[model samples]
Target: MSERTTFQDQPHRTVLLRNGTVHSPADPFATAMVVENGHIAWVGSEGAADSFADGVDEVVNLEGALVTPAFTDAHVHTTATGLALTGLDLTGVRTLADALERVRAYAAARPADRVLLGHGWDASTWPEQRPPSRRELDEATGGRALYLTRADVHSAVVTTALLDLVPRAREISGYAADAPLTGPAHHAVRAAAYDSVTPAQRAEAQRAALARAASLGIGSLHECAGPEISSADDLTALLALAAQEAGPRVTGYWAEAITSVEGAARVRELGAIGAAGDLFVDGSLGSHTAWLCEPYADLADGAGQRGVCHLDAGAIAAHVIACTEAGIQAGFHAIGDAALSAVVEGVRTAADKLGLARVRAARHRVEHAEMLSPELIAAFAELALTASVQPAFDAAWGGDDAMYARRLGPERARTLNPYAALLRAGVPLALGSDSPVTPLDPWGTVRAAAFHRTPEHRVSVRAAFTAHTRGGWRAIGRDDAGVLVPGAPADYALWRTGDLVVQVPDTRVANWSTDPRSGTPGLPELTPGGPLPLCLRTVVGGHTVYAGPNE
Candidate 1:
């Protein structure tokens, strides 16, 4: 571990990154850049370096790697993501048999005293659909197994023996009355199972997650969870993990679903410590519970489920108003068009009731505005809602004629990740990996945004970069991030590429790269393949927290 040292004690003080093209974003481009005390002091040509050579401490050669603002995933579940990183990953397991084999192997290696837990197995994506049961898990874990949760994190599969250990699991919220465990009841057991892990174990999981994020050059994240369901204790535990003397910086959005002014007050108190509050207006698309105008084309149970509206229209309006009045910004999770509409109404009603001028001043936002009618595009801008989207979602599943089309059909499928449309409509676009749901990689995220499955909706590489970097910071109401300008935070990522021309293009036009399947030279520059594209070095607030061996 590196010692915590002051800038004065460090060998490098006035460092010159000369000859490399600096994409200040504020300016068209600069030839070189100078970093002093962890902030950009000057950006110009290589000749500008000589003027400060007398005061120079160390000089670094760019070697032609693209230097840009480090990414910040605006919406992420840090603790869950961290645990997933260390647990038995069945994320890619196709069959129930495949999942069982992995669980059995994991259980074989564990001690009797240890309670086995794992994540990342989505039944929705599996060939043998519906979630597994306790009986199946019991067989998988031998006799002493406690396998919990698939990808959604909203549900889990626990062995009978494991459920016996936690007696309350026998009667959980979302579980079916006749069944041993199912639905929200199963989720409650999963949450309780998570709580069973000691603070020390939880902290370790968080540490592993932050380490991975640092390696990927993600400088910040928003931790979203329900209020009573996903308590402040969870956020505190995650913050404790990131609070290590050596770790990347982290900001949080505490997603509490409470609708009272008192609930808003508690969230406001959390904001004093840099945590934002999040609300869920609807369920996820995969679950087929997102409130939509029309029924899902695939599921013809009529309009399908209209989604879970936990609060009434008036209550929804009150919650937004309460959060804003308490001086805390709110984020609403609205995955379906109907949910999006409800959120829009809530924001508008809240604004109208509390004066639009003052409401805009609060900067409240709507998270995951994924599915929306064309008519609602302008409404998002009108309501001043920030679209907290996960670009990596499209990259993995939204390939041409893939799962999205299968789930949403053709017409609705076209709107999978409408980056360009939202941007043009003046909706503040922010990028998030929603880790656990998707891997957290900025380049892959940019690739997804810049090269959408549907070509027309694709955004420029610069525009995608902005969403992942600056737009993310703005999503959380901060301007200090995502820039290389003077007085900005000394946080940036360096990617070694063969030719910087493709990445740092002259014209601002969106350029579609060769297919990822093709062995194009450009792909290797961003994704060096081995060890997740080596972070090189990660500095937060002018202090180096992570330095790769390649550095």
Candidate 2:
């Protein structure tokens, strides 16, 4: 295979993509697409492709590959994803010992002063049911520990060395009045770990992650750079990395608490407004920190702890008001029911206090309406709040008798995500991957949403596609993205199996592409036997940012 050329400047390059089945996500499903300088010039049958009568400069047959609007992950920590791509990965390990072993191996491979950064270790699922302590890692690293964080990013377990490097960590905040920096303070230590990384190293990590995302067909990502930890300079580093044109388009979001009038002004000065970054009303369920009305099912404490509310109602309302007053769009992380409710209340309070028209104009949003009651789902449309969620999370963990189920109990777990319910209730949906927590595989996300592992939450593939594409563009107020039609940005993904069909198996067994060692029926993984399907030849603004090797 020859290396594909990335055209930086268009020299009358009128390329015609013929015979491809296009999922324009528009009314049409299959049609020839014409590209002139990167934007779709026309979309119709070869007969109507005569619009290219100006004479095409180049012609390539799509060979019936699926040409769909490229996916936009509505929520992700791009810098974090990039770092994890090159650093240690502990995503699917079951025991704390297993996690420590991975970190120990990583530590052995590198020398001291070289900060050990890692992600994707979920303490909730581990039998230990708690994060690995700094002391445990201390032993693992031969007392030279500098391990940083778990997967949720909500917390971190740092060695004494790391704590010494970040003295502020000594004054950890956000826990009960008595406790030390063990909880959210660990998040601070994680921030310190990021500082240890050089700008060049961070950029390289970002580039590698973008390459991974491109290989999986993701063209754009919403980088949720939390302000509580990441300072303006951190965001600057990320933006500087993003400007490199290496892999995917990065849209950044700063944390809400830090989005002060001055901070909002700085972001505008930094040229980050009308883009990414927002506040968190609550934490995540994986951390058992999501603000919920009812408590965890298994917790012995009769009084279930409704999830954490990082921002008080007044602070949340005030911030929303401030962001709106400044004409900046905001996104809030709301996973649990109570947290979602609080954010909704905050938005409503902000609007009512500052006037609804003004708040509506700002279009400040709520991210991840993961566990919505029917009432809240209805309110999302009324409030015009954007439910930025990761569908793949549902397919992976929201299935029958899964962790989420055990946490929320059957009723609540079954209703988690509720895409069909939300859409039907008129909630505007936006899809994201929440990378490092989940894979940035756009097709897999679409597949999960389309084929709801629980079946009850299944949404049409078209709707899921729209949520991933158009919905994300709309969420960030990008009019040109998520559309392949003319006059829209020429951002799209070209895949090999656009029309591949899948049916629900009669047996309720997980499909593996390869035969399972368990020797169970229908247990072979559903692997595409042919060439890699859904390989991304992603193009943005007519520039070939990423192309599959097959090209």
Each model's lDDT comes to 0.67, 0.70
RMSD of each: 5.1, 6.8
Using Cα atoms with residue i matched to residue i, what is each candidate's TM-score against the true structure?
A: 0.87, 0.87
Candidate with maximal TM-score = 1
Residues 1-551 of candidate 1: C-alpha lDDT, one tens digit per residue: 23434332444366777655566754435657778877877777667667876777777677665566778887777777877788777777898778888888888876653568788777666777766666677777777757566565545667776666667756654455323344456655666666667777777777887888878888777777555335567776665556555566667666665456677666555532222334656666665556677777667655334445544556678777877777777667777777777777777898888898777767777676777666678887877778888877776667546566666777787876677789889888888887777877877877777667777677766677788889988877887768888878777766554544334222355343544343222322232132234467666665566777777
Compared with the true structure, model 2 gives a TM-score of: 0.87
List, residue by residue over 23-96, the lDDT tens digit for candidate 2: 66343544578777757777767677666745887776778666777778888777678777887888888998
Query: Candidate 1: lDDT of 371?
Result: 78
**Candidate 1, overall lDDT?**
0.67
